[model samples]
Target: MTEATVGEFTTRASSINRALDQIGDKWCLLIIQEVLWGINSFNEMMAAMGVSRGVLSNRLKWLQEVGCLRREEGVAGSHRPRYHLTSKSIALYDCAMMAITWERDWYQTPALDRVELVHLPCAKPFVAQLRCACCDALVCLRDVSYQPGPGATRDVREKKVRRRSSIAITEVRSEHALYRNLINVVGDRWTSNLIALSFHGLTRFEQFHQELPVATNILSDRLKLLVEEGVLEQVVYQQRPLRYEYHLTEKGQGLFPWFLTLLQWGDTWCDPQGRGKPMQVTHNPCGEQLQAQVHCSECHGVLKAHEVRFTLDGEDMNP
Candidate 1:
């Protein structure tokens, strides 16, 4: 899609989509991960991510423009400047933690298994759990409902004829990369909205289009991308005219926690005036209002931003 088209769609008040548009590309998240790991220099990022220098440069520039990252001068007369995560980007720790949790649970591979996260306070390898902030109950997909918010707009424009990019972002892959793969699957706003809608029981093309206010062309492209990524499986519901329904595969369902984290974050930070959080979640099993919270699986204590540290294959990263 053209830049104008992307801007048109993202103009809507959906905080999740807006957030995705800013930092949802394969290279963006990987860059953030590198910075979080203390690999901040441009040369260091290029060497570690194996991306073209041009791509790295573009991604970094976009990230800085969005205020997710900032550049600082090097020490003394050093040539290599450093990029640091702003508070805005640092707050994404929950999202990244949830992604890693989902990757470990549903997409475990030899490469993923080699990396581990340790909760320093707990002194043990830990998993992240999404619990209700309201009642400390587990939050699931079936517990939430949404409506239009104050920022909601009915500005869906007529479809514009456009050519697809010659190189689709979804077709790009990184070597044994977790965050890149996750972003590749749900990189764009439309694709992320489609996945969120699928969790709401909207499966068919018309259903997704109705709820998302996205162009049919954009919706179709996202659906095809999801199916290609094995997150959504397209099944024929009717043999005549080849009617099909998209269903979440096991891998897709595993993304529930990540989405929940995003929703909670949006509600807390993005909405502010209670306008954007049009959804209310309830813990179905416990019959209480839900606000997802991330906690350490080992100690069952709340996972605060300052309490966690990283380790790579049993070595402390001190990150």
Candidate 2:
């Protein structure tokens, strides 16, 4: 593997990066999703996720090592082992919902369309929505501001990082995934990092390069992919020598909820040093700290893991 500098000079520590380091891989996220949906056995996960035996085994071990999953003995007389989500992994439920919401909004995901989400508290079908806990107001990317938090530190990144995977998400063979498009975008560590940096108002290529410290070619390829995916649009900023600035499109802005939920999850579960938080976000409209909450669109009630159920083909699949 070739070496890539994550950061040459000091850069602010980010919970998002830490979280990505653990679960940002394409297979890793998909495996976690499968386990969350009750597909925990090795063979079950392999068939459901369309992942190879070796890759699946590696990711399963990695997940266990990272505290996202735990290996448990199967039922009495069974020889196979099973995987289960830990509290840390379960906390990612909000991110998953936001991802589903974004995917349904952007693409015609038949699998997602067939699956129905029901909020048990309200006893009604609903869509997921993000709201600020401070005032119960809908949270938008435009209305959020952030600054360094107590956990913020100048991080000197590792000099050697793995090269990005060559395989594209669309090329992966998955038959039962709800957030395929979302995965296609953020499944890669660097791609997700770019999206996170964009939320911090980064635009220019040089700006992203400085913050990410990825190889120039890899960074360029990711940017082009984002543009092709319609998440980012390039605007001509200079005519001489042809310079441009990247700006998020409407579709990209729609991902704010997902990223916000992920950031909160990272802050809670990925902080190894117990540093408070890497960044503090404030709701501009409410003038209070932003505390994100996922709620049901139909009832406006907060969503809890045990308080949600899924229905597929008129069959209740409660988790």
Every model's TM-score: 0.83, 0.93
- Cα RMSDs of all predictions? 3.7, 2.3
Which parts of model 2 have CA positions greater than 4 angstroms off? 1-10, 156-167, 171-175
Candidate of highest lDDT = 2
Question: What alpha-carbon RMSD in Å does predicted model 1 have with respect to the real structure?
Answer: 3.7
lDDT of 1 by residue, 73-145 (tens): 8888897889999988888888988888877776645555776777778888798888887777665676665
Model 1 TM-score? 0.83
List runs of model 1 lying over 4 Å from the truth.
1-12, 149-178, 210-221, 268-278, 285-289
Clash totals, every prediction: 0, 0
